[model samples]
Target: MHRSTRDIRLAEALVETADTLVDGFEAVHYLPRVADHCVRLLAARAAGFMLIDEDGTVSLTASGTHREVALDLLRAQRGGGPCLDSYSSGRPVPPVSIGAARAAARWPEFTERALAHDIAGTFAVPLRRHERLLGALNVFVATLPPETASPDDAASDDGTELRLAQLIADCAALGLQNHTAYVQCRTLAGQLQQALSSRVRIEQAKGMLAERWNTPADHAFVALRQYARRHQLPLDRVAQAVIDRVADDAELRRGARGGDDGGRA
Candidate 1:
């Protein structure tokens, strides 16, 4: 397969995932989707997902989710896996072999268990958005050495696949960051609209009060606002009541006069 092309596709998929999060993406829901995409584009044989919570503990949100959820969660709890290192350090962890790792047992629990399950090597990469560490993506494979697998066979192409795996991790990070930004903007927009509407109703009430009391519009506005503040009532509700009583649209119109401070009750 075309490795570069596959990597590019993986990046695009990640960006799309990020976009969802922008509009308030859910971790439990989206992580599974990410796992699916990685399985399709990367040469990952089996994949899992994880995220770092506020308490500084990383939790597995989903596992081989597509294949072996049980083993995946076990690796995450044991906590010595490559993904943990990559996430804490904010760098990509290289693919690792079990036989070689026996010297030190990088992830004693994860290594032993995965090896028992017949996986020869594993790749763990982090998912980060901005400085926000989302979690890790873990993959298990059956072989490692190109020479040992088959000098001319497909397993020899693992180098290209490893590069693609890195790209996938990056894409996942970006997706998470993008989602956060989108949710923020949406929340801000809602607040702004509410503020604008409140302002409009308050102005309408001021005009009604001015017409009823036969005084300057600004003075009427000031009295209404002061009353609302004292009563712990919303300024808009007070304005609505004043308008209901007076119903004088002309007095409520804007551009009343210069230097008209509404606080001048």
Candidate 2:
């Protein structure tokens, strides 16, 4: 029921990093932070991330390929590795060697290719939302020399590393979620900006329509709304209709020219 001091320190560090991410840490530099944490704390030889696209496909997005560049894109079309599996399962997947996960069988080609690079083990941690799947954080370990233990009992020594890997995975998921939220906020802000710009443009064109048709501003607005409803177009598009050189449907254009006071004044 007691936690170790080392775990407490690790947890505190993760909390600090996650807090930084929540506070606008979506810069290009953050990927290296993730990589450093994995490499320094979790015995990971390599670190990578997969971003989940809107179409539900996961693509490799970042990697620590060298000591300087810090991020690289894989030169292959392959995904659905341990990272994808972890995202789908919403849990940690640690293949401490190809054998523990039989990754060579489950993901034959990727396993073979990754092993050729001395990456013989992998762990995938899911980046999840409350109810949505976001992405994955992946860690790979280089194969130890055969002379270390003949590669037969290597797993026995890997147990502690595996546990630490999972813990690191949890921290990475929290960090990733914060970054993802910041990304979504940026996307929503862009959409809102476009909408507001369109509205103002439409307002300007509506004013033009009222002047040309000699109609009151209110009447001009009515005509625009009616046209939009009749044609099943958005209001901004209708305003554009009156401005663009596209169409000049007489009745609608005339409505923009002037207003009848309707006698109730």
Candidate 3:
């Protein structure tokens, strides 16, 4: 591909990746798309990514193709490879020409699987923020270009490939961060809404008791609490029952008296 064309495509890919940082981002849907772009635009044969959850287990997040999906799972199952190395160390793993016997020897099981699957090269970059690592992005190349045919041969374009991988990984990291924050915010909002709803029900029930018996609102609240405690029901559920008239005024009066054998007046 012409240098100008490659540059334009690369810029476009970065823009597309960055656009996923919306309020309700879905990582499962976006990561694979990014992997596909890497294969198509970065001359990679395939691409896959792994995410390390809070529990420290590796999850195969996305793959550019079906073969890559299986291969990524194998790497995770084996527990050793460029992906883990990059994620654990927060560094980039240089492209390995898997076609070469020596290159394949570094990750023996991974190489065997790669050979079986017709994948001839692999590269990885970490998804990290400062010292915190989230996961790794991996790319599989069928064969290195002529000048860098040998794994030991350092090609000028290798740096470019590494940068592109890093760019994509950074985008994935940002999207994940945004998604996490969005979920937490939603959880908090839901909790607040539930609390407010419960409070409203309790207050409404108290008002009903106060008007029916000409008692103070404070005394009515005590009656609600005593009933909830004596019946072993949640305070909110009992309040709801009172509001719905499921609990009669006589029952509420008994509850107001504390449900004791020697009840309060």
Candidate 4:
């Protein structure tokens, strides 16, 4: 890709990441788009994203293609690949020659699997926000000559590609954090709305019971609460029942009489 064209695509990818912060953002869809952008912008054969769970298990979240997905799955299962290393260290893992004897020594199973898939080299950058590590992005190189397959290979020796990859990862991490906060805020707002609605229903029920029993609203509320406790039902449910005229009138009146006596005492 030309330098100018690649720059335009990079800007577009960053914008896409930011766009996901809005409502209705789906991680399942967004992650694959990010992985595809990585592969294209970095001129890599394949790319994938892996996320670490709260329980410390790393899993493949998305990939540029089915082949990359399989490789990512193998690496995650083996738990000793570049992506895992980057996530664990909270730093980028430089390009590693997958077929190297040293790589075999370091990550025997993963290296063997990657070589079998015709992957010559692998690079990884952590998806992190400062001290908080979320996951890692893996880049696969399919064809690197033996002479240039070292970690200091010309492909990324200048560090331009690595820096670009890290910038993309950082944008993704920030977008994910924003999405999580937006979801939490929406959930909290829903809970507050429900609570307010429930309070309104309860007040309406109290007024109805007070008029029916010819008693004060406070006494009627005591009766309603006692009925709910006796029936082992939620206060909200009982309130709704009173509003719907499904509550037992006789039982409520009995509770009202008891409340009256208590008030007198």
Candidate 5:
């Protein structure tokens, strides 16, 4: 791709990443797009995302392609790779030759799997929101460009790519955080609504009981409370039963009388 065209595409990709912060952001769908962006816009042959779930288990969340998915799953199952290391350390892992002795020693299983897939080198950047680490983005390099053939030159170029990857990962982390907050807020709102509905039902039940027993609303409420306590039922549930006429009026009256007698004693 021409440099100007690639720059335009890069900007578009960043915009798409930022768009995920809006409503209806699905991580399963968004993550694969992130992986695809890395491969298309960066020096990555393939890309994948690994995330640490609530149980602290690291797993392959998404990948740019099936082959990359398999490679990421292997890393997750066997438990040591650039992605895992980056996520655990909350830092970037610079490009490392997959065939290097140190790579083999540090991640023997991962190195073997990566080599079998014809990947030459790999790097990782942690996904973070402020100081909190969410996951890591892995990029597989099939070969180095001629301009970065020397170790020093390769390191310098890798540094630039690493920063770009971190930028993408930062956007992903923000999207994830926003989605979490949205879900939590929705849950809280639902709970409040349910509480309000339950309160309305309880008040209705109180009025019905007062009319039926020819007693004050407060005394009727005491009867409902005593009945619920004796039956080991939720107060809302009992109130709902009263509203539904499922509870026997005579039985409740007897129970209320028993409570009054006990209080007098």
Candidate 6:
């Protein structure tokens, strides 16, 4: 790709990845798409993502048909590689020539697997949200012969590839945060609805008990609490049972009367 064309394509890819933030895009679905963009715009053989979970274990979250590249990324978490190092240090791992002997020595298993897939160079950047580390993005580029120089070789273009990778990583991180916030909001909404529903049920059960036993609502509540404790049941569940007529109304009446007479249920 020509330098100007490559730059334009990179900008387009960044825009495309950024657009995902506006919708309900899942991290699993979107990160791989970004990886594909990285492969196309970075001229890499394949790309993948490794996510660090709450337990601090890293797992391969997304990849393409390049099974060898995917395997190398997974093994990287265990034995250590550019992706793992980048995620840990919150720094980009610049493109490293896979043909260099030092590369093989640095990441033995990853190098062996990568070389098997004809990958020539590898680059990685941390997926970070501000100061928080999320994961790392890995791009496996085709090897270039010494005679065929890369546009990134120019002093003016130094760190350009790494910067592109970081930009994509930033977009992925934002998508992840958006997804997480959405999930948490959904969970809290569900819990609130359930709580409201349970409260309604409890109130209905109390009214039913008060009418059945000819007792005040507060006395009915005391009866319900005592019966629930005696039966080793949840108060909400006992209330539900009462509302459902699963618990005997006669028994509840007796319990309420007894509780009013100093016998707690």
TM-score of every candidate relative to the true structure: 0.75, 0.52, 0.80, 0.82, 0.77, 0.76
Error of 1 at 107 (Å): 1.7
**Candidate 5, superposed: residue stretches over 4 Å from native:** 1-4, 15-26, 66-79, 99-106, 144-156, 257-265
Write down the lDDT that model 2 would get: 0.61
TM-score of 1: 0.75
**How does each model score on lDDT?**
0.64, 0.61, 0.74, 0.78, 0.76, 0.75
- Candidate achieving the largest lDDT: 4
Error of 6 at 176 (Å): 1.7
Estimate the TM-score for candidate 6. Answer: 0.76
For model 6, where is the 10-residue window of minimal lDDT?
149-158
- The residue pairs in collision within model 5 are none
**Tens-digit per-residue lDDT, 1-265, candidate 1:** 6455544666666666655644436866676677766665654456776677778775564433346643463354455767777777877777777667755766677766776676677776767666767777776666445554333223325566666666666776776666666777878999999888888888777766677668777767767755666567777876776667643334333324433455632
Q: Rank the candidates by lDDT, best first.
A: 4, 5, 6, 3, 1, 2
Best by TM-score: 4
lDDT of 1 at 114: 71
Off by over 4 Å in 6: 1-29, 73-78, 101-105, 144-158, 258-265
Pairs in steric clash, model 2: 213-256, 213-257, 213-258, 214-257, 214-258, 215-257, 215-258, 215-259
Off by over 4 Å in 4: 1-3, 22-26, 66-79, 99-104, 144-158, 259-265
Candidate 1: residue pairs that collide: 18-175, 21-179, 22-179, 22-182, 22-183, 64-67
**lDDT tens digits, residue span 131-172, model 5:** 888888888877766875543223347778888788888988
Model 6 lDDT per residue over 7-123, tens place: 776777777776643446666677777887776666667888888886987667555656456656557547878888898899998888777834448788777777777877787
Which has the higher TM-score value, candidate number 4 or candidate number 5? 4
C-alpha root-mean-square deviation, each candidate: 5.9, 8.5, 5.4, 5.0, 5.4, 5.0
